[model samples]
Target: MKQIGVALWLLFLPFVLFTAQAQESKPLSVDVLWQIERIGSPQISPSGEYIVAPVTRYDMDTDKGESQLWLFSPDGKTQRPLTAEGLRASQPTFSPDGQALAFISKRHKDDVGQVYILPMNQPGEATRLTSVPTGAYGIKWVGEHIYFISKVWPGKNWDDIAEQVKHEANSHVSAHQWNALPYAQFDHWLDENREAHVFRIPATGGEVQAVTQPLNIQLPRSSQSASSYDIDPSERYIALVSDSLNDGVSPNNDIFLAEIGATEATNMTPQNRGNDYNPMFSPDGQVLAFQRQLITGFYADTSNLVVYDLNKKTEKVLTEDWDRSVRGLVWTANSRGLFGTIDDAATSRVYAINARNGKVKALTGETNFSGLSISNNGILVGTNDSFLHPAQLVKIDTRNGSTTRLDTFNDALLADVELGTYESVTYKGYNGDDIQMWVHYPPGFDKSKKYPLFLLIHGGPHGAISNGFHYRWNAQTFASWGYVTAWHNFHGSSGFGQEFTDSINPDWVTAPYADTIAAANWFAEKDWIDADRMVAGGGSYGGYLSTILLGKEHPFNALLIHAPVYNMYSQMSADFAVHAERFGHYWEKPEIYRDISPHYYADKFNTPALIIHGQKDLRVPVGQSFELFRTLQSRGVDSRLIYYPDENHWILKPNNSVYWYQQVRNWVEQYATPGAQ
Candidate 1:
């Protein structure tokens, strides 16, 4: 008997060792999260021969991050960095012939990001392509010219613009003057005086020629990027997104089509009432595609794809019958199909839409994919990420939906990190409607033992909690601390359909609040959950929901709210009003504002809460956090307020983000003990 036992132990030694090794792995930490290299969207060559993407690495000591352009081959064999380390490089664009690459970089004595071209076929250093004093961005290379957008004085030349920039820097006056409605965006104040226009220079270097300047039309005042404009393959026409009304307060974005050097442009979508933007010219130069939304005030309105024929001068709405909004669009080589990364259900999937028939077919599944780029041969490259991993550059198979990872970024960092498990679940919510949610269990989770629950409310009121790896409010990170974290796709969450997303407008409290309570009750019924120990919170819209919970009777011991819109009346001071234009102004809809605002229910505030906000949060305004904090204190509830002076709406800086995570962990652990008991 003793000899037989020794022989059996030897047979199972390898299996026992592997299990021990898996059990010894550590859970995800803030430090490990920072250590992972973040990869940007892939920019594939015209023939699908080379792929270049920006890889960013953070230094905890410097409290900064540096990005470098990295090169990858589609066969998954070659991986190397194109740009030098410790320099800023982004906006990678390949030449039409795929012989060279152009990107924005601020190196050496450059004051701002400028266009730099690197030869892909030859062993040569990157050559400075532009010397624009106003700097260059939103770059695209077409035919024999390189196009870029620059904010400049409309009538001033390059030298004059440079002189003006120098004068403004040397001047002591810090005040800004604005005469328009969109005086500020999310974080920074906008200069209403400067106009953003497209400019192009010869590939061999020459005088810059204005593309949109001659038309006397400026890009949208609030924001402009590469997606704001497109140059046709023939280089004969340019399509740009500009405000049709030119009234900043309720500006309607529309597409303007013009000949490359024409003095006047035609408004293509003059009949549409809502916003229309993201003009993309098909490779064949026959069609122009753009996204359109019908509602003026709702930022999260469903965006449908529309295409216009250049020859026929007719327009068609391709995605009018579809329920999902299309984003990150890329035209295929044949120009017969358009590839878009869509927010479908709870995942961000890549879909191929037949441009001719308006039929949509999902090309990727499960995980989130974005930054789609296609080659002339129909090859697709993009970034794929999930809850357990950061984004990796991938070459997606257009036919079978399989992906060949082009870059091995963050693989070593995550090798020893035992990330938690998560799954999609459905529960009875408001009106007994099924609400889909993501529930994450801690590493080494045991069903026999009871664990604490941390319910996370997602913001966006329209932003659905997708399956992409979240950096700011990572559910897996919360689960790593030994608590089961969940993100509920409650009422008003997008991706389910247009009707479900618009269900909670005007009255924001009823459905979402009931769904949240139902989520807690659902968890309470689970045998593995400790019914007495529960916490919930979110940011932006999520923060608003958490504040609502503070005033209502719920199954939560603590709440964590960040950058919340506490008082609806005072939210008028925000950069954008929530329900003013489309629904009605607060004065016009007094009862709706009064009932839905979280501040009105402060009399019932009793739950301990942690309120976090940034001084530069123009979206929700820093005052919202203060109002919630004061109300909690006035009600004699246990509460804490954390303020980030150098941050914006998000804790972007590395050290600040680490400190934020630490503080949140400290706050949550103070009330509800983590781990199973």
Candidate 2:
């Protein structure tokens, strides 16, 4: 009798824990989204024994985020923070010997971001390395030197720059003048006089030396980061990105090679009119690998992998005819191949490209993989996540593509949170091509009942909503609102073939517009979806498309357009002039702008809309949103506009994001209440 009672108690324990877990697993909310930890890409040591990554946490009440560098063993044991509270470090790069880690941080409250070094094997705190007043970014550790990029005033030293920055700050100069095309980037104003160039410092602590300043070529003004340059293992030759054209309206980034101390740099591929970037040297330092794009204005052009033979002084387009774009470019131990993440049919996969024949083979499938770090032994480590799962540290086997989770971050937090279910489906879209779409259902969804639909249109105009966990503008959070949320990788979305991506280039309407409406009609046919109560919304280009939907006859009851490019003529005031080079200026090609510009079709905007924009949004100016709101008002259409004074491109502040979501919910509820009937 006693043995039987003990067995029954043990059996009952499992059920009790399962019920407790179920009770804790509540629906995902904005609060939960903010509470979850964000893990960045892991940086594997040269020896492949350790991995370091930045982990960010947000405080809802404080409405602030804090990032700290954390170290983890490859086997998923012994996780610890390398830096303590109040200190934020980013872009961690391990030295060749794997003895020290170099990162960028602003240790002093008033100090600009500078390079700092922390000993990997020692128990000391991080020591500041560079004191550049303009701040150092895109840090890299190679051989015996630490390389970084900084935008500095010409003919000025460190002290002079510091004084200049202080003077500029103290001087209430409210005017900004630009003589050239690119006066601003995505969020910040670019100083036309200040040049962004690569500089180097000895790893053992020495004076900073300018590498590209004397070359008389400035890095691309609007876009330049760590990927723009790479130092060879020999530290003899440096490969950097620059453009011959100073027009600035067109980005003509090309790879330029220069000796370590030479004053001259030669353009490697001046023949290619498009963009070339992400310079990486082979392990043996004989071959240089970079990504090449074909189109200049179309940012979504397929990136082909190109390898430049140093001895031969010739270039080969490896992925010439391939349909997908290469991301996170990395070299193998033998320099025989490259590894990176690629988007394919609404999924991000890890692929290995054979350097010899350009044969592409996917290593991992389904889940979105990012922050790829490869070592000499062919060990690849990155952060992988799915729609239902948050990012986790992972190790990828370059040979078989098997993945091993290296860290169990947010597992407990997620285990206690009930998440909705999602799946990838197909539908015939524009051009009769098979289009992929992802549908997210509520946590306690029931197919027997009818639920309101929240159609989510992705931006990038070319980027896909892949199988990944997203904190901002999350589909799951929207699904938690008791609606069937979906993301359609319509025409012009990448990951499909090149033809499918470039199909909507100049038109920017016809195909994607048709596909979006088709997706709506497809979901309307489903018995479980309440077609009449559907709401559609998006950000950036997504907002642009939703604006297009407003002019067309759509089933959506309400629309949410955030940071939309409404007027083509007004968009020229943005960071990059849209369609000026591709379709010619509006004056030159009036029909192209007249036909597609949303403002031109304002007479048909009858649907209610909620408009949102940020003052710092340079990609799609906030003025665009103002123009849209005014048009809706002039037409007497029901509309509301929300403006952010401090935020940029996206709602980044925790409080601001929460408020944005709340207001959006209110707007959706006012127009089309969510829930299943």
Candidate 3:
């Protein structure tokens, strides 16, 4: 009996050890993802001694996330939260003296977000700085005054606006009327009657004074943020972004320059038909720099950096010859060069552009860098992340492009999470041109084993898949489910130069569709990929492409379409129509719409698919997904439709997102089957 018991114990010991090892090397899941803290862009002080960023944490039970300001030392040694937990805080701006910090938050009796100021060098509670009924955002602490942007009813004072808001909330009428082109943006409806303007208040707390409201010029109706306007160092002048046309239909964004107290502002870019915004004044206030795009309808047009000499009142295009778009521009201390995050060849890199001659130099290579903030002493701090890691605050050495991690918010959560490896591979796509793609291998991946393929298509048709950590459609998360994932940057994807981006202009079908097909063929030849168990899909334009696949021949065993644009003609009902301004409308170019619209080939629907859409998605209306789902059901094809009424373009709620991932896993596993065969 003792010998038999010893043998049984030995057999059970091996089973227990295997279970412990499996738990130790757990893959990323939706529950674990919610536990990771998300760090926003860092704001460096004028002296570069102090840096502050907003860190947000989510609660699964509450299905909400709260942000708090966090302070970090320049040497990357000290880090702590500046605000109490459970309260939301954002848009941290440092005072010119670097002794105080100001941010927007809603606390205590505040019904909306108000400006709160805190002492940096001393221990003290934050004090409310503004009581405006409309609330404030996009704050900047410049000179002796704090500037902020707020949307208010036109010609209404603080008292009247407060009363109006109360009455509206109590009113029974729920209908919204709009007599304009842009009635909605992404998820929410825009108040056409209200106008967004800049306002200023004394740092010590006093009466609010309207800056642009008195000038009778308002920021763009569709959107307005910190990038909408800029104040000069002397606080003598202001440059703002305003629309050249007020009718809303095909409005052109142009920069307007005005004196600090003047009631009239001059239109600076009236000759340019395309959009020109993000007016940034140089350190010396000698030049005002902004971005310009020549094409009227294409939102992904190349953004060229242009400078205006304040003294001479002349405009010069600094990046006219460059193909890449200039984003997140920051003027150097000396005003001789500017650093910007540019999307280049499937990567978001930091590039230095000479202010005088437009000579461009690459600063950082690999991964993704965003929310660039530079101090007067030339300390660059930004948020950096990659496929295997979440966003981390880093101090970048401007000269050498070296980076030192500043904050360790998500370090502990990610320490034990076994992440998959990814690589950028180039393959011959449409027209025999090389297309770049990111391929992710599952954790403990072996070349000797055959795995299923999860092909993810990116939207924007113009938005390339750069190296960044994405929570919504994470490649590693899918790869963890025992499948190899890949994102193909097909034709029309940006960051590959202007010609490649514009190749699919009027016809959004031919080139991209062919490129996707080629990508699958390239993967089918891979020794590790099991072509028989391949699945493909995407969101938005990616979904449109998936619908295109539904009507055509492909190697995919299943499709996952999210928020797709099914019918080109019905797409005009969306807040922003596709190809209406650049290309003629469907009535004018009926052949183009008929030939490319996915709904036109509904008879060919045969593939099993999981369709997901949100009701509030105005970009690609929820009806698009419903239309495709209905078509699939009518044809007796295996399909599943998951509707999210509260979600917008993306699944955001904690519980809803977890459910979405589970449904996706279940649907994919039923068809393709995960793990090595």
- Range of the 10 consecutive residues with the lowest summed lDDT in candidate 2: 407-416
Give per-residue lDDT, candidate 2, residue 258.
96
What is the TM-score (0 to 1) of candidate 3? 0.97
Q: Against the correct fold, how does model 2 do in TM-score?
A: 0.96
The parts of candidate 2 lying over 4 Å away from their true place are 1-23
Whole-model lDDT values for every prediction = 0.92, 0.89, 0.92
Report lDDT (Cα) of residue 572, candidate 1: 90
Ranking by lDDT: 1, 3, 2
* Clash pairs (backbone) in predicted model 2: none
Which tens-of-lDDT digit does each residue in 144-197 have in candidate 2? Answer: 999999999989988898899999989987888888878988999988889899
Q: Which digits, one per residue and each the tens of the lDDT, describe model 3 over residues 589-634?
A: 8998999999998999999999999999989999998889999999
lDDT of 2 at 542: 96
